[model samples]
Target: MTKRIFRAVFLVSALALAVGLAFLMVVLYQFFGGQLETELKNEASYLSIAVENDGAKALEELPEHAERVTLISKDGDVLFDNRADASEMENHAEREEIREARERGYGQAVRTSNTLAEKTVYYALRLENGDVLRISSTQYTVAALLGGLLQPVLLVLIMVLILSGIFASRASKKIVKPLNELDLDDPEANETYDEVAPLLGKIRNQQRTIQQQLSAAKRQQQEFSIITENMSEGLLVIDKQTDLLSFNSSALRILGAKAAPQNQSVLTLNRSEPFRRTIDAVLAGGHRTELLQVQDGFCQLIANPVLRRGEVAGAVLLLVDVTERIQRENLRREFTANVSHELKTPLTSISGFAEIIQDGFVKQEDIKKFAGKIFDEAQRLIVLVGDVIKISQLDEGCLPYEEEEVDLFQAAGEILQRLHDPAQERGVSLHLEGGHIIHQTVKPILEEILYNLCENGIKYNREGGSVTVTVRRGEDGAEISVKDTGIGIPKPQQERIFERFYRVDKSHSKEVGGTGLGLSIVKHGAAYLGAGVSVHSEPGQGSEFILAWRGKK
Candidate 1:
């Protein structure tokens, strides 16, 4: 601030000095060119009359002065001179002042003397006797005559310089004082300096706008911090340099990072093999999403630039813990592949058998078996296709339900009855015990949930495994459980088992003719009807799948 003030003062002083010097130059030119010319004019006119009356010889002999006098002919032939030989003088016939004296009685002109290399003024007058008088004065002679004027002009220049600097300082202060007043604490004090009130008002209004922007920025920062901190997935913000500017606790844990302190960079923060490539691209100003590996999981990074006034100030990198999102994406892709494969198997078998029959390749003795196999594949296709439709309809909220109150015991019995033949064929015992009359969404939708659960329970079972289906009432909603002595689910795959096309084992699930979508439909159905589902399972132990219907509220 002090430097800025001094700089402003210095600049004004320089301008003031320039202006003062220019004014002095003008004053000097005016004094010498105008006042001195008039003085010489009067002196030359008086001397001309003296020379005309008192002959050229008397004029030349009178003084031998450098303010010299000479006489010339009407044709500009020099006749007399005070200092130099008349014949040596240059021709003055072509001179305007000399020609004017011969024709118009008098004239004046200043020119450089060829002989002396000095400036001289010549005033010429026509004499009564028809000769011309030429009076000449060198510039030095005029300067000496105005010698007294030199001291005053020099003094004026000195005074101008000193006074200009003083006024410049005072004027600069007066102009800048308002700015100092603008820095005062009291907002009201800004108005007292009326000389700059409008400008101050504009500054205050702009300040208010800046404060508003700062407040909005702070809010966005706080919101971004909250999201990064509280999210289950990890997050990181990297700058254009790919240095870690900020990150949440989840990011640290995900990166397995031990080096990212408050001021440490991303490079400093346990930069393992995966993050290096992403950092490189970001630093190189690549605008794209880059995926990197951190620890054992996946990190999806998006690199973008922060622009200020149309230039890139830095980059912003958003790091997401796609460990789960990637898994979900892989699951969805796999699910589609599995569904395609499952549907194709039945179709392929049917098409092959049909082709054999059409081509007359199947022997008459074996045609019945081929027919039966074709029928079975067709039936499996129907079931698989129906399950797909059911799950998709549930997702789209298109599955219609009857909300009539149904006895939980009756519903459980009916679902178990549908599963009894399959259960008995597998040598699995089916047990149903119940005690509730719950008001819930029912009919076409509710019956399917029970059937799917019971079938899944028995189908996934070991031989002679018992499937206990229970229906009971709780404090608010009804409870139903399908406890199965099947091959239990692993801890990791448990969460995703209810998703579409998921199976514990594909070969075993195919042998059991499972569509892999029944549980997903069940989950979505329960959720749509405002119910809750939970699970309890161990790796070796049996699993319990429970659904609680929402009570009328």
Candidate 2:
């Protein structure tokens, strides 16, 4: 703006100077030309009187002068010339000034000299002797005058332009200074031009509206961040270009991303086939679910297209950890098969014994023995059915027992007493130790856990071995440990000992007459009662099972 203003002012000043110089030169030229013509007329009148009085002798007697004097006859003859030979001069009768003088007494004409930067002014008078006298003088034209004044005019123009530029620069700066220093952040607070007051007021209003919008956007972002950050499931948002737009920390963790993947290609987060395929399908406006292997576990990826105005705009992805669910499904299938086989064994035995009697294939004396065998198999079936029912109830969490304060030592004694006859039959000793520690728990569940552990100890122990039950108050909780001198489990198989229908020695399990669900029941019952059960064992040494519960606050 400053440069433009300077240029404009400078050019206008230079142009004005040029125009003024031209007008002054024209006026001066015309004024001087008129004065020179009047002088020529007077000189002609004096010369005409001289020529009339002295005839041709006046030309000879005249003093030296700048004006050219011409004498012409009425018959169109050049009589005498002051500056040139009379005989060589052109005929004067045809001259405009001479013709006018003959008809109108006196006449004058101004004509430019072709060979010089001047014009000739001629005055002619018709004498009473039928003769004409003419006086001519030269005057410089406006072009010559302007040429003489060129240097001074140029000097004045240069000074004017320089001053104009300086003034324009200062003016531009003064005009824009208030705008440059305005406080846009607080527009209304600035004291500037009133001509721009409306604009400043509008700016202030816009600032307020922009601030409100920014605040609202910030709050929404915080809310979204809170929701996503706290989620357990991984969530991801992407654009149609497959660029990662937003994602939660859970998404980063689930995808094993070490850095933020925002605004990058979704494939940069994960390059696995399932992940890529799911993203591709979703971006194509399809919903897809795929299983992705992440380290030692599995994750379920669900991708759905995000729609905007009935068009695919982007996609949303959800990641769920399904490792535990998959394991449960496998366990359920295995349990079903195990139950079928276990029930078939006892039912087959009972059917065989009864069929022998019904077919009359046994003697009368052996009939009682066959009935006894059938009864024993029936009893085994009953025990198996009862164990299955208990496990199912624990799995479904439908137990009717409620919480109560029970004597832990007393509970151990009661379980041992119930298993004492079996212990005696196996030639294993049963003992109860520790204090009468009272623990808060469900009595039925605790008793069930105790019975299963104690019975297993007796059933698996060697002859003359001892089965001891100890109850004590631990640092954080009540503890009950059932230790046994038995053919201990192998270290490698210890973890699986709590699984349903698992047996170290299948032949020994048959001889011991068990449903093979004792330890499984103990595990489930301990879990339902909010306790932890662990075991320590060596092959030849005794095995110990410990159940601990957190202390009441």
Candidate 3:
């Protein structure tokens, strides 16, 4: 800005100086020319008077001067010349001054010399005797006049340039000082030139708008950070160059990264081959997913491509923990296979016995025995099917029952009565003890829980062993316990006993005559009623299954 100002000032000053010099030269030239012409006219009149008085001899009698004097005859012949030989001079009759003087009383003319370096001004007067008298003087041309003054003009121009440079620099600094000191942050508050006020107002408006936009952007960034930090699933964002842009705490934990991963390459976090391949595939405009065993558990990694204008810009990686889900799927497959095998055994027995009777392969006396075996197998199939249906309903949480206040003691008594025949067959004595402890729960679920527990106790007990049902009210809640002198569960298998078709003594499962879903039913039914079941047992001493419910106070 300062340089431009200085240049403008210097140029204007130099142009003004050049124009002034040219005008002075022209004015001086015209003034001097007029003065010289006037002097020639006066001299011509003076010489004419002298020659009129003294005849042609007056030219020779004139004192030596810078002016040239001449006399001409009426017939175009030079009579006398003061500066040159009159006899040898050319005729003056055809001269412009002589011709004009003959027409008028006096005439004047100016002419350049043959060499064109100088000019002469002539004034002619017609004397009374009909002779022409002329006076002439020499003057320099316009070029010669300027050449004589060249040194002085150059010296003055040089002085002007030096002074202009100094003034230009100082003026430029003065003009730019206000702008340099302007407070741009608060443009409207600055004290400066009125010509700059509108520009400053525009700058102030833009600054306010930019500040608002910056504040809004900062708020959004904070909100995003808060949300991602609190999320349960791992989230990571990367750019097209595979550099990590952002990541949540969950992502850091899932990847087991020991450092904050911002602005680092994705490979710096996890450089496993499979992980790299998945990221590469996603970044190439494709979506990829894989299950990875990371650290102590299983994670489902989903890499989705981010697109902008039909091109892949980056990728978003989502990691979901699916360890429990995987375990449940495996359990489901095993349950299905076990159920099929369990059902096929009884079905095959029934089919074989019935086919023998129908084919008449068995004698008449063996018919009753074959029919009885078929009936027993069919009954076992029905029991197995019913147990499966009950378990399915419990799992789906659609078992039909209503919540009500029911006495645990009474429910236990009813279950004991129903299992009397089974108890007699197993030679296991049954006893009910404890007060009438009232608990708020679904009645059917409570009954189902007690029946399965007592049944399991009787089925797995030795002959002449005892099964006891105890209902008691404690400070926490109502508890119903079924204790039996049965073959106790082994410590290692205790946790798995609640699973479907899991029998502690599988070799004697058939002789025990159970669908192998008794304890499973008890577990599910107790869970539905919001109760807890635990077993206190040791090998061969006995086992106690306790069901406790914490009723609302």
Candidate 4:
């Protein structure tokens, strides 16, 4: 703005100065030409009179500054010349001024000299003797006039330039001062030019609009942060340039990133070859999924390309924790293997004994004994199959019995009565204690729980050891405890005791007359009833399994 204003002022001033100087020079030129013409006319009048009175002798008496004088006859011949020989001069009768003087008594003309450097004005008068007397004076041309004024013109131009520069500087500053001091943030509040008010108002409106847009954007960013921070799955967004655009807290935790990873390359977060390849494939418009073992657990990384106009613009990474799922799959595989082994053992024995009887390999008297052995093996197979089916149903969370209110103590007593013969056979004493404790649960699941606990107690007991069933109301809810004075489980193996087919002493599994699913049933049944089960045990101090009905309260 300052430059433009200064330039405009300077240009206008220069143009005006040029025009004024040109006009002044033209006026001065015309004024000087008129004065020179009048002086030649007067000089010709005086010289004509003097020459007529004294003839050629009067020319010698003429003043020195009175330039060239000429005498011409009526017959077109120069009679005498003061500046050159009369014989060598051109015919004066044919001259422009003399020709006009012959007809009009007096005449005037101007012409340039032969060299073209000087201009001469001619004035002539016809004397009383019928001859023309002419006076001429040389005047400088317009070029010569301009040359004489060059120094003065240059001085004036220099003065004009200086004045214009000073004026332009002051004007430019004056024009820009208000704008420089203006508070653009609050444009309407400033006191400035009325012409600039519209621009200021526009600035104010745009400022307000910008502030509102910034505030809304900030709010949106905060909402996105909150949602992603609370998510359990890791999320990441990356651009096509391999720059990370966004990273959530879950992603940071999953990648074990110590700092926020925005605007960085994905390789900086995870430099592993597989991770880099997965990102590359996704960026190339492909979808990829891979499992990575990270600090927290196994994470399933799923990279999906984000498309724009049928081209890959970026990608989104979803990280799901699959550690627990992998563990459960492994457990299922182990359970399948154990089930096949356990079922095959009894079936093989039953098949062998029946085949021996059918093939007549045994003696005739031993046929009944072999048949009895096959039946016992078949019964063991049936029990094992039944336990497998029950465990499967429990795992699927399918309850075959309806829930109802029942006395926990009564349930314990009934389970003890059912296990009395087994306890006696094992040489273990059975006892029940505690007051009545009622709970609302599935009756069959409760029965299954109590039956399994008591069976485990008697099955793993030492000879003459006692199994006690106790039920009572507790602070949290109903408590049912089955403690055994038996060959207790080792401390290290206690955690796996509730797993299906997990036996503390595999060598004595058959001797204890169990399929190793008794405690597993207890665990599942208690879980189905919304109860908690824990065990207190040491290697030689015996074990106490406690089932607490926490939901009943």
Candidate 5:
């Protein structure tokens, strides 16, 4: 705005100067032209006084200025033309100055010379003797006058433009100063501006509030980082631009990656099909669960919304390490299937034989043996079904639980008495390690876990090998370990040992009448009781299974 105004002022100034100069030149031309013509007439009349006083003899012998003296007679005839023949000259009576001098004593006119075709200005006067004296000169027109002034006019214009540009540059700075001072970087300039004090004050207050908010946001970010870093699962946050803005250590470890990735599209990240589908689902407005199963194992991504002002801003993905859970679920499914299949065989056989027996299709001597086998199979079926139901109840926390102080030694002795027959038949030696103590709770579950663990140990052991049951109170918990000198589980199969229906050797296990629920029950029982189960085993080296529970004193 200021520049425009200044430019307009300078242009107007230049125009005004040009117009004023032109007008003044016109006025000076008229005044000076007229005054010079009047003076020429006066000089013609008045200089005759000096000539007359000097006399005709003096005029005839006129000094060096005689060239300007034109002697004319009273009767419209030239007496003596100082530079021309008197007789050859034309009549002067038709001349404006001569004619006017004759009529009104003096007059002036401009006309083209008859001989030369050049223009001239003439001044005339009536001499003392009624004779006329005339003088003439040429004057240049206005165009010629202006042309003569052109150089100086152009020089002045150039100076005016230079000064105008300098002033405009300075003025521009003044106008732009206020805007620059608002940056708050130049202390001196900022201090100099008090016009916008109110606005600056408000900005300062708002800045303070913003600073506080930024500090709070920073704290929240740090807190979230710490929480996710230590978490057992991975977490990923992506923005609307599909950039990976935030993540955690667990996420890095799970993805086999390191370093923080930001400002990159989701496709640029881990690009497995399942993971991409999960990202697409998140980009859409839906909660989805995508499971990625690879060679190492399974990972479950839980995508959720990050909302701001009731609108989704981005997505938060939880990368849960579900290898264990998936394996467990698969085991549960297999367990159910196995239970159904195992029971179906016995039931079908029993139904078929009973139907035969009912029809009296067998001999009386064979009836006892058939009945005995049927009863044994039926017993086995009952045990298997009962064990499955018990495990279900234990998992659901519906199993009856009672805590008490009991003697570990005495409990072991009682359980050993019941397991004696199985142990002897298998040629397995049983050893008791710890004495009685007050640290006991949930006696039934405790006994069940011990019995099932020991049974599995003895069942899977080598002939004439040993099964040792050691009950001791650890610093934080009660521990019971079942160590067996058996055909030990391989390193790879150790993880699946506690899974339902999993047998080290299916043929060997069925021959020994192993229900496969014993170890499964032990696993579920110990877990339901808020305990941990750890196993150490290698092929041909026997296995040790340890269960840890909170000590009850």
Candidate 6:
């Protein structure tokens, strides 16, 4: 702005100076021209008087002068010339000055020489002796005059230009100083030119608008940050340039990043192939979902593009921890295969015995044994099917049972009575300990849990071992623990004991003649009653399985 002002000021100043100088030169030239013409008239008058008094001899006697003199007769014959031979001079009667002087008594005219470089001013007087006397002076033309004064004119012009530039620079700064010092915070309050007042008012209005927009934007950013920061799932916002614009702590944790990565490429957080593919697909205006290994678990990455005017502008990425879901899926597949294998064994034996009888390959004396063996395998198959159905019901969580007040000690006694024959056959004694403790729970699920635990104890116990079922009131809940003098589980296998069809002693399982799902059913039934079940075991020592339910509200 200062430079513009300076340029404008300097240009105007220089132009004005040029015009003034030109006008001055023109006035001086005209003034000098008039003076030259007046002097010629005066010289002509004096020469005419001298010629009239003394004739040709008086002109001849004139001293050498800068002015030219000419004498011509009334008949237009040149009688005398100061700088030329009289006899060789042309007639002057037809000349403008001579003709005018013949008629008007005196006349003046200016004419350019043949070369057009000089102008001669002629003044003629018609004398009484019937002759005209003329005086003329030659001067350079206006163009020639200016050319001769060019050096001084240029010097003055340079000096004027220099002064103009200096003054213009200072003037421009002075004129713009008020604007520069204006308080933008209060533009209308500034003491400045009235011409600039409207602009200041606009500036003030614009400032207000800008401030309002900035405040609104800041609030929106804060709101967005709060929402994203509180999310449990990981979130990421990226720009079209692949730069990470925003993220949450969950995103950092999911990516296993040690620190918040600001203004960096999203790939810096996780460069895995699936993660990169998800980002790339979303950036191309597509939606993508990929399962990636994150740390020791699994994450489901969902990516979607952000669009503007039907164009992809950026992307939004969401990460969900699917570790538990994936583990459940794997367990389901394993359970299906194990159930098929467990059922196949019993079915195969039943089929073989039936085929042998149909083929008449069994003797009459062994018929009873074959039939009894088939009955045992059929019973095993039925038990396995029943257990599978129970597990399915627990998983579905829609059992036709309601919560009721159940006495834990009474429930343990009932379960022991049902297993009495099995315990006696296995030579394991059952003991009911602690007083009756009432707990609010689904009665059917609780009974199922207690039954499974006791059954498992008798089936897996050593000969002459004892099973103790205890019920007690805990600080926060009612507790039921089933402890057994059985072949203990190893520490490494304890964690997996609750898994369906899992067994610590595979060889012992065949002799026991029970589905390897008792502990799994115990776990599932406890869960349905909103209780927690855990086990403690050492390889050579007996095992303890404890189930605890929350106190009534």
Evaluate all candidate structures by whole-model CA lDDT and list the values in order.
Answer: 0.76, 0.87, 0.88, 0.87, 0.77, 0.88
Model 1, residue 76: distance off in Å is 70
For candidate 1, the TM-score is 0.52
Q: CA lDDT of 553 in candidate 3?
A: 28
Which residue pairs does candidate 6 place in steric collision?
Answer: none
lDDT per residue (tens digit) for residues 378-430 in model 5: 99899988898988998788987777776776787778778989999889989
Which residue runs does candidate 1 get wrong by more than 4 Å? 1-260, 269-274, 277-286, 294-299, 307-313, 320-325, 361-366, 395-406, 424-429, 460-465, 474-477, 485-511, 527-532, 535-542, 549-553
Query: By the TM-score metric, which is better: model 1 or model 6?
Result: 6
Worst 10 residues of 2 by lDDT: 1-10
364-439, model 1: which lDDT tens digit per residue?
9999999999999999899988988887787688766657767778888888888778888999998988775656
Would you give me the overall lDDT of model 6? 0.88
lDDT of 1: 0.76
For model 2, which pairs clash?
none
Between prediction 2 and prediction 3, the one with superior TM-score is 2
- Separately for all candidates shown, the number of backbone clashes (residues 3 or more apart, or on different chains) is 2, 0, 0, 0, 0, 0
Can you tell me which runs of candidate 5 are displaced by over 4 Å? 1-139, 149-333, 361-366, 400-414, 424-427, 435-441, 462-464, 473-476, 538-541, 550-553
Q: What is the C-alpha lDDT profile of model 6 across 1-553, one tens digit per residue?
A: 9999999999999999989988988899899989998888888877777777778898887778657888889999988888989899888888999999989898888899767689888899999876888888888887888889999989989998999999999999999999899998988679999999989989988999999999999999999889988887899889998899888998888778888667888998888999888888999999999999988888999999999999999999999988889988998899999999999999999999999999999999999999999999999999999999999999999788888887878988999999899899989999999998777788877888888888888888889999999988777788888999898889999899888999888898877877888888888898888888989877657889989877642
Residue 151 CA displacement from its true place in model 4, Å: 4.5
- By TM-score, rank the candidates, best first: 6, 4, 2, 5, 3, 1
How far off is residue 313 in model 3, in Å? 4.2
The residue pairs found clashing in candidate 1 are 240-315, 244-266
Error of 1 at 332 (Å): 3.0
Model 6 spans with C-alpha error above 4 angstroms: 39-73, 76-89, 114-116, 127-130, 175-326, 349-376, 406-439, 457-487, 549-553
lDDT of 3 at 334: 81
Clashes of 4: 0
Report the C-alpha lDDT of model 2 over 69-116, residue by residue, as the tens digit.
Answer: 888899878898888899997787888999999999988887897667
Alpha carbon deviation, residue 357, candidate 5 (Å): 3.0
